[model samples]
Target: MRKEEKPKIDARLLELLACPLTKGPLVWDEEKSELYSRLAKLAYPVRDGIPVMLPSEARTVDPDAEPARSARSRRE
Candidate 1:
């Protein structure tokens, strides 16, 4: 039997996925391979190319602070 393939996410989809916290959108950092939630100010890591979207998997994000790539990735 052929194994089912997990859905592949791309830059476009990353633009669509949002952070559960603060109801804010997510930004993908291709260089660091992490997902950043602008509103939540938390950074979620991508494992083996898959984004761990769960809140538990997400680290703390200081909404008042700026990420290194915040200005650039805000649109992602």
Candidate 2:
């Protein structure tokens, strides 16, 4: 028998996790389907349903226009 690997965050967990930068509520962008921090103006990609909270793993939003690629990408 094999045990199923569960997601790092479940529905309840999602309710608890907030934006590290803003300390404000985050919304799940169903379109990009990524966890977005509006206050932080960053979008953290959820890989395999696991949100990478690291700032390095995040993409920044251009306050002027639209969301742009993060200037600082995740270092190895």
Candidate 3:
């Protein structure tokens, strides 16, 4: 028996994706399997490698928080 591998979001797709609300760039958090929009202060989920870009689907994030700030810094 073989183990199933989890799907991963494509790099090109990430580059093209943006926050639906602020239209700002997003940072990918591989550990959390979510895309963070610092400008919008939201974390959009990535289910089965498909990103749910809808603002309603995203969870509110604290931009000043350590984790959120770390994710943003990693991108820069």
Candidate 4:
């Protein structure tokens, strides 16, 4: 059988979560499967249905333009 897709994050938990460093809002990014903390400039990854919220585990992000949509979008 094919592997099942990861489950979506629970709405309650998503609403309660915020950026650990900045204590700012966390935006759920479905396309890249990440939780973006715009103020902190970090993108926490969602792996195996769980959000990895640690700052050390977060990837750097660009606020002006999302890297996920930048390249292809700019070309068009």
Model 2 / residue 52 / CA error / Å: 0.4
Compose the digit string of candidate 4's lDDT tens values, residues 1-76: 2355644666678778888999886777766778887678899998876889899999998777654432212111
Candidate 4's TM-score reads 0.74
Which 10 residues in a row give candidate 2 its minimum summed lDDT? 67-76
Better model by lDDT, 3 or 4?
3
* Most lDDT-accurate candidate: 3
lDDT of each: 0.67, 0.64, 0.73, 0.72
The order by descending lDDT is 3, 4, 1, 2
* TM-score of each model, paired residue for residue: 0.63, 0.64, 0.75, 0.74
The lDDT of model 4 is: 0.72
Best candidate, TM-score: 3
Residue pairs with clashing backbones, model 4: none
Q: Can you write out model 3's per-residue Cα lDDT over 6-38, one digit (the tens) per residue?
A: 455677787788889888878887767788888
On residues 1-76, what C-alpha lDDT tens digit does candidate 1 reach at each position? 2334333348567667777777687766665667887767788887766788888887886676545664335463
Better of 2 and 3 by lDDT: 3
What C-alpha lDDT, on a 0 to 100 scale, does residue 38 get in candidate 3? 82
